[model samples]
Target chain A: QKEVEQDPGPLSVPEGAIVSLNCTYSNSAFQYFMWYRQYSRKGPELLMYTYSSGNKEDGRFTAQVDKSSKYISLFIRDSQPSDSATYLCATTTSGTYKYIFGTGTRLKVLA
Target chain B: SAVISQKPSRDICQRGTSLTIQCQVDSQVTMMFWYRQQPGQSLTLIATANQGSEATYESGFVIDKFPISRPNLTFSTLTVSNMSPEDSSIYLCSVALASSGNTIYFGEGSWLTVV
Candidate 1:
C-alpha cells in the first residue's frame, strides 16, 4: 500500500460552495501533514501545513488532521474559480527530509 | 521564504541526450532536494543535495541516471543523463529552511519533454 493515499478527484463545485479534500496514510509515523496546490504546468505550492492531530485555520482554508485514523483534510470555504487546481497531500515523519505524496485530487470551481 | 530559480524552465530534448537543470536559491540553505513529477502523477523525490558531499538518492534513482552537484549552499545542479521519453517530466528544485521548521519550498520547475 502507498504511504499516502488520496482520491484523484476532478471534483467540480460551484463558486461559493464549500470544498473538502482529503487523504489517508498508512504510516503512523507520519507526524506532519501538508496540502499543496498546483496549477497546470506549474510547481506545487504549499497551501496548508499541520503537525500531529489538530486543526489549523488560515483565512478561508482549514486543515484538519486525525492521527488516530491517519486521515487528513483541507477544507476551503467560499470556493472560487481561482481555486481551481490540483490539491496534493503530503506526509513526512518528524526530522525526516523526504515526504510521501498522494496522487492528488483535481478540483475545478465553476462560476 | 527562499526564492528558488531553476534554469531551462521548459525544454524539449532528443532521446538519448542529456540535460542539466540548475537550481539557485536566494538564501543559503543546508539541504536541497530534487523531485520529478510525471504527467498526472505526484512528485517523487529523486535525491537530496548537501554542500560538500555526494548527493543521496532514493530507491529506484541512481547517481548515473540523475547526478547532482551541490557546490555551494545556495546553488545546485541535476543532470538527467541518457534521457528517454519516460524521462519527460517536470523537475523541481526544493529547499528546506531550517529556520522555518524545515518547511520545504519549491522552484518554478523545469519542464522537460524527451522526444
Candidate 2:
C-alpha cells in the first residue's frame, strides 16, 4: 500500500459549492499534516498545517486531522475559480526532515 | 520570507548527458533540500544539502546519480548525472523557515526534459 493515499480526482464543482479534499496514511509515526496547493507548471504552496489530531479553521478553509484513523481533510467553503488547483496532502514525523506526499487531487471550480 | 532564484527554468538535454541546476536564496539558510516531481506524481525528496557536510540522500537516490553541492548557506546545486526520458521531471529546491515553524518554501522549479 502507498504510505500516503489520496483521491486522484478531477472533481468539478460549481462556484459557491462546498468542497472536501482528504487523504489517508498508513504510517503511524506521522505527526505533522499539511495541505499544499499547486497551480499548473508551478511548485506547491502551503495552505494548511496541523501538528496532531484537531481542527483548525482560517477564513473559508478548514483542516481536520484524525490521528486515530490516520486520516486528514481540508474543507473549502465558497469555492471559486481561483480555487481550481491540485491539492496535495503531506505528512512528516516530529523533528524529521522528510515528508510523505499523496498523489494529489485536482479540483476545478467552474464559474 | 526568503526569495529563491533557480536557473535554467526549463531545459532539453540529450540522453547520456548531465545538467546542473542552481538554486540561490536571498538570505542564508542552514539546510536545503532537493525534490523531484514526475508527471502526475507527488514530490519526492532527492536529498538534503547541509553546508560544510555531505548531503543526506533519501532512499532510492544516491550521490552518484544525483550529486548535490552546498558550498555555502545561500546557494546549492543539484546535478542530474544521467539523462534519461524517465529523468524528465521538475526539480525544486527548498529551505525551512527560521522560526522552527515547520514551513518550507520552494523555488519556481527547474523543468528537465530528456530525449
Candidate 3:
C-alpha cells in the first residue's frame, strides 16, 4: 500500500462552488502536512501548511489536518477559473528531509 | 523563499544519451533533492544531494543511472544517464530552508523527452 493515498480526481465545479480535496496516510510518524497547487507546465507552489491537527485559513483556502485519523484536507471556497490546477497532498516527519506526496487531484473550476 | 533556476527547462534526448539538468539556488541551503515526476504519478525522490559528499539515493534508485553532483550549497546537478523512453519525465530540483521544517521549494522542473 502507498504511504499516502489521495483521490485522483478531475473534479469539475462551477465558479463560486466549494471544492474539497483530501488525502489519507498510513504512517503515524508524519507530523507536517502541506497542500500544493501546480499549474500546467509549472512547478508546484505551496498553498497551505499545517504542523498539527486543526484548521488553518488563508483567504479562500482552508487546510485541515486530522492527525488522529491520519487524514488531511483542503477546502477552497468561492472557487474561480484561476483555481484550475492539480492539488497535491504532502506529508513529512518532523526532522526528515524528504516528503511523501500523494498522486494529486486535478481540479477544474469552470467559469 | 529561495529562488531556484533550472537550465534547459525542457529538452529532447536520444536513447543511450545523457542529459545534465542544472539547478541553481539564490541562497545557500543545506540539502538539495532531485525528484522525478512521471505522468499521473506523485513526485518520487531520486536522491539527496549534500555538498562535499556523495548523494543518498532512495530505494530502487541507483547512482549509476542518475548521478547527482552537489558542488556547493547553492547549486547541484542531476544527470540522467543512458536515457530511454521510460526515462522521460519531469525532473525537479528541490530544497528545504530548514530540514526540520520540511518546507520544500521546487524549481520549475526540466521536462525531458527521451526517444
Candidate 4:
C-alpha cells in the first residue's frame, strides 16, 4: 500500500462554495503534513504545512490533521475560479527531506 | 524562499536519445532533490542529490537510467537516458530550507515530451 493515499478527484464546485480535500496515510512516523497547489504544467507549490496533528489556518484555507486516525484535510472557503487546480497532500518525518505525496485531487471552482 | 531555475523548460526528444535537465539555485542548500510528475499524476521522487557524493535513487529508479550529478551546493543535473514515450514527464528540482523549518520548495518544472 502507498504510504499516502488521496482521491484523484476532478471535483467540481460552484464559486464561493466550500471545498474539502483529504488524504490518509499509514505511516505513524510521519510528523509533518503539507498541502500543495499545482496548476496545469506547473510544479507543486507549498500552500500550508502543519506539524503533527492539529489545525493551521491561512487566509481562506485550513489544514487539519488527525494523527490518531492518520487522516489529513484541507478546507477552502470562499472558493473562486482562480482557485481551480490540483491539491496534493504530502507527509514526512520531522528531520527528513524525503516526502511522500498523494495522488492529488483536481478541483475546478466554477464561476 | 530560494529562487530555482531550470534550463530547457520544455523539450521534445526522440526515443533512445537522452536529455539533461539543469537545476540552478540562487542560494546554497545542503540537499537537492529530483522528482518526476507523470501526466496527470503526482510527484515521485527520483533521487536525492548531495554535494561531494553520488546520488541515492529511490525504488524503481536506477542510476543507469536516471543519472544525477551534484557538483556543488547550488547546482545539479539529471540526465534521462534512453528516453521513451513513457519517460515523458515533468522533472522538478526541489530543496528544503532548514532555516524555514524544513519547508520544501520546488522550481518551475522542466516539461519533457518523449516522441
User: Please, what is the whole-model Cα lDDT of each candidate in the order they appear?
Assistant: 0.94, 0.92, 0.93, 0.93
- Residue A94, candidate 2: Cα error in Å is 0.4
List of chain A TM-scores, every candidate: 0.99, 0.98, 0.98, 0.98
> Model 4: residues >4 Å from true position, as ranges?
none
CAPRI grade of model 1: medium
Candidate 3 on B6-107: residue-level lDDT in tens?
988999999999999999999999989999999999999999998999999999999999999999999999999999999999999999886436689899
Model 3 TM-score (2 dp): 0.97
Alpha carbon deviation, residue A1, candidate 2 (Å): 0.9
The CAPRI-style docking tier of model 2 reads medium
Estimate, for each residue in B1-115, the C-alpha lDDT of model 4 and write its tens digit. Answer: 7999998899999999999999999998987999999976778999999798999999999999999999999999999999999999999999977677867999999999999
The value of fnat for model 3 is: 0.55
Q: Rank the candidates by DockQ, best first.
A: 3, 1, 4, 2
For candidate 2, write residues B1-115 as lDDT tens digits.
Answer: 6888898899999999999999999998877999999998989999999898899998999999999999999999999987889999999998886765776778989999999
True contacts kept of 1: 0.63
Query: On TM-score, who's better, 1 or 4?
Result: 1
Q: How do the candidates rank by TM-score, highest first? A: 1, 3, 4, 2
Best by lDDT: 1
Q: Comparing chain B with the reference, what is the TM-score for each candidate?
A: 0.98, 0.97, 0.97, 0.98
Clash-forming residue pairs, model 2: none
List iRMS (one decimal) for every candidate.
Answer: 1.0, 1.0, 0.8, 1.1
DockQ of 3: 0.77
Write down the TM-score of every candidate.
Answer: 0.99, 0.97, 0.97, 0.97
- Cα misplacement distance, residue B98 of candidate 2 (Å): 2.4
